[model samples]
Target: MSERVTPGHSGGLITLGTADALWAGLTNGSAVPTVSAACTCFPADVRAGYVLLGGRVVATVKAGGGQWGVPEMEVRRAAAELNVVKMDHGDLVRIGPFGGAPKQKQNDTAPLRWRQRIARELQELGDVERAAPSEGRLHHLAGIDWRVLVEETRDRTVRAWWLPRAVVRLLDAAEHAETRWLQAARTRQNSTAAAEPPSQRRQIRAAGGRQTTSPHSPTTAPRPYNGELKELLYSALSRKHGISRKVAEWMCAVCRTTPATVLDHCHEHGYVRAPVCQSCNTQERPDHLYSNDIRVASHYTRLFDTHNVDWLRHWHRCPGCRTRTTLPLPHLAAWTAYIACRSLRPTHRAPRGRKPCGVLRVSWTGSQNAPRSCLLTVTVDFCPSGEHRVLAQIPYREAAERFGTWLAETAPAVAAAAGPDRLDGLPTQPRPVIPDTNSDGQALF
Candidate 1:
């Protein structure tokens, strides 16, 4: 008959060990006996090992055996069902799901092996909790599904199970080996990203293009980097009136709700005009390559012809804002209607540290500590035919009374339509803060 095998007893395998010294020691039973600490046999130089149960050696780890870690969750449930303390020896069994039963199992007098403990735990927890309960990466690495058969070799030996320091050393080595590669991959990705042009596209591709980082002052602190990116962004195109995409993006051509995403370019010169949002890029810009500006002056060549009394017969709309007044004069006329309502204002000044906004998000109440005020500015953009003259900015409120008096005398009907205290014309020459009355407070009229 074939030799009868004992649970965890490997007298036969001991003679066949690859190492001569280890084999000799096992053959003579001179091998230092040790214990299994789940993933590995601990206390080095030990050839024969015992798998313990409640302080007793129920089976040998054998001359040749597999190893694994006891998952934390399994240990807890098994201890609870087996009536063993969860923290004590609960994580001991780290050996694997062996292919088959041990030739014989040595059951401890306490009557609980890993299988009995886990089985009782599973039964008590019921199907829902027992099947594929929540587990982590470490649990997958250490715990195996198979259990060792324990009844074949029953014993009264008792020993507590704890992972020796040797096992911890082995785990640390494995972790260090894997982490090196993960860290290297992250560094390489950052290098590749730094090569691209700076764009404020920090949000994930799937996150609807929302910004990833915190926002700061649009002028002093631009988004995605800073004003430093402005020059480089349009260096290839044009730099005459270069404005950073960050500041320009805050305003759109059509509406302030959406941000400008593209640089508005001059079609004829292939130069950067201004930063414009995506909506204006597609909708606001004219289709034709030439005269593509949205301004009404470009489309209505008749207005540029000599200004005549008849020109006032047809009411015109302001090209910039489409604001029409009852003056019945050409919108491009030298005079502007004096309205009593609030006018467009600027919050730009040198001492205050705020520059003029190329594109503005007008509603935000800016820094409380800084000097802030909005003044109405009017431009009398009168250019001779065939000549393009940049209109000078004249303080509208400062000259309101003088301009209004001139309009009242020159165009009484236009002044009446403009409401009271309205300016229907500008003086041949400009002056700042010319009140309706002289220093004596008498009516200048």
Candidate 2:
């Protein structure tokens, strides 16, 4: 089972975190928005010599491990810089939304999952070459950075490597995943190489970087995301959004790969919702209540004039038996009047059984004595043509002063659709009964 991340989890979110966040960003088509290459690469070595001269490991730890004058302190400091928790887990671990004395164990499942998973994959893919891309190392075999390769049997257990733990986990997970996973990674790599002008690919090959492919490209259709792979993606999202890992997993299954920016997970299931941003999430979370603005009392009172407008208890049927009970219309405080501009549809409760909408015609009947006499018409053409067709024309005004005032007082529903009422006493129309319409918009049951 995948370990989950929670604010109150054993070590909080940190326990579920990897050494770096950048790896997650890169794989997700983002670079660490805040972290920089100059930041210390914890648990990983930084070839300072090559970094300064080679512009790679400008800020990293050193290998042949021992101690370089308070380097541990520097690593801890870097963890603070990244806003992740840092603590002494045999060798000083880092993870979480906040940095402090780590409350995690050396056997942290988050790291273990990556180490064991990759070791197994490498054993299966047959060990490839490990190098320091920044070190200018030359070797044959499908080249991989030493940052990810396990140094020895015991080394995998130690949480120390420059590459982000997430980066390592994903790279290895590919060994067992479908070809697309690896193909996506390769495509990313090739795209990066292609952008480097001239022959960056040739340079990589010259530096002993061998082209790699998926283990086996099946001629058959690609498989659905396996549970394990889904968990990994979920964890990445959890790390990003601070939601529980399980919630993220559920979101990945229901919504999409990424979580929303604010809520992060389904409010009900406690998992990632849908296309996370506000614009997309509107469609992503159809039933999701994004705000309480419509529910608050203050906002409600301003929406209606209790004297001029009133709500009748309306009920279609009872939740049980699906039959009309003693229930009346639920209380609504002129909810339709809260409609903001730019919205084609008015704000109202989603009705059940059928949608109640019709045309509102306001025409000038010409004048007997009044010249600007406008007539207001509220027409409901239910079913248009049906056995139970409902055609109702409401009261009209012959000497109406303005279209807005007449519609607001007599046909408030029409005015509410055209625009929201500005003040009290302005009419907020209610929907009239219409014929049944199925989900497909077909008229009648």
Candidate 3:
């Protein structure tokens, strides 16, 4: 019969012979006790006693010298003394004082889950932000001011379960903040870059220490003259006016001397060949006596008025004679008026057809009432006799248009009449005349 014992049993200690027998039974697996099947049972007091005595348990089947084994009886005694039932081979044991499994912990698990979830959230947020346009004021916020949230929450510690959300928020904030900072830096850089001065900024000093505002300096541009007044005068006459330097020097020499006194003191008594003496002779001569004058018809001399009378000065020489002559005011006025009337006439002829002939002759015809009235005969040059004459005593202004019409009708014949006289003095050899043509190949007047 088995006797049940409590925790403080004095007979709990196993005898040495019984301990040896129990050790053999325990080592041979023949000491399967009848305690709770789920509990791990062993001869606790017997094992403790064997340990105190420095005895080692061994398998009975194995050969070993320090091999003390436990038997069934010793195991039962130990289990009963300790107030614990024996257990099967596969029973569980309690590690700590409370005799139950300590609470399982996963310290790293929560943080790992947080990191993964935050990473996924941050990735999604980045995709959304990246898809937005980078323009306008909102873009400015997205680029610059968003990073503050990230730095603030980066190292925040929270409950392990909340780690995922925390990390996501922190990363998003950090990304936004970083983008904002970079954008702000770029904006500042752009503002600085956009600032530029006007085209005409300031005067800069040249390599030679000269202050210049012009695009090109004197050294690179044309140099100005730097000389005395006399030298400047000489250079102006020679270089600017294309006069020979020797001629300028000779003029200066003559101006420097007193005319008569210098001439008398010189070896040549009166050197008329000298420009100074020649100039004096020219100045003394009367211009009218030195030049010849030609008489032009009074009718052809009625073209001028007071305002344009000065133009006659340019035609001082006669076309017949190369002699220079001046026209009286009346003659100038008359010639100008006559030319004006002639210019108003349009007598151009087409190239493909034969043109008509026309002529204006001022002959003294008989008329008692108007003695000054001349017979103005308009005749075709082809029929020079008065048979083809269109007689009319018209005023000068009215005659211009009539003459133009008549000339237009009879241009060919009229041109032929004047051709012989026009070519009489000219050389018989061919002279080149440049004809003007319009874009359409028509001759331009």
TM-score for every candidate vs. truth? 0.16, 0.18, 0.14
The clash count for each model shown is 13, 18, 32
At residue 41, give the lDDT of candidate 2: 35
Off by over 4 Å in 1: 1-249, 266-273, 287-445
**Which consecutive 10 residues in model 2 have the weakest lDDT in total?**
313-322
CA error at residue 35 for candidate 3, angstroms: 99
Error of 2 at 197 (Å): 53
lDDT string for model 3 (1-445, tens) is 2223334543344333444343333333322221121011121122111111111111111114643333334344433332321323221111111112233343311211222333343344453334343332121111111221221122253111111212222222223222233333345434544674544343333222322232111111112211212212121332444232222223212222211110100111111112121122112111111011112222232123332222222122121111112122222222323342344322425586733334323222322123244222222222323245433334333333443343334343432222123323322332121122211111110
lDDT score, candidate 2, position 386: 30
The digit string of per-residue lDDT tens for model 2 on 199-227 reads 55422111123333221222222222223
User: How many Å off is the CA of 435 in candidate 2?
Assistant: 35
Q: What Cα-based lDDT does every candidate model obtain?
A: 0.26, 0.25, 0.25
Candidate 3 TM-score versus the reference: 0.14
Q: Return the lDDT, model 1, position 232.
A: 30
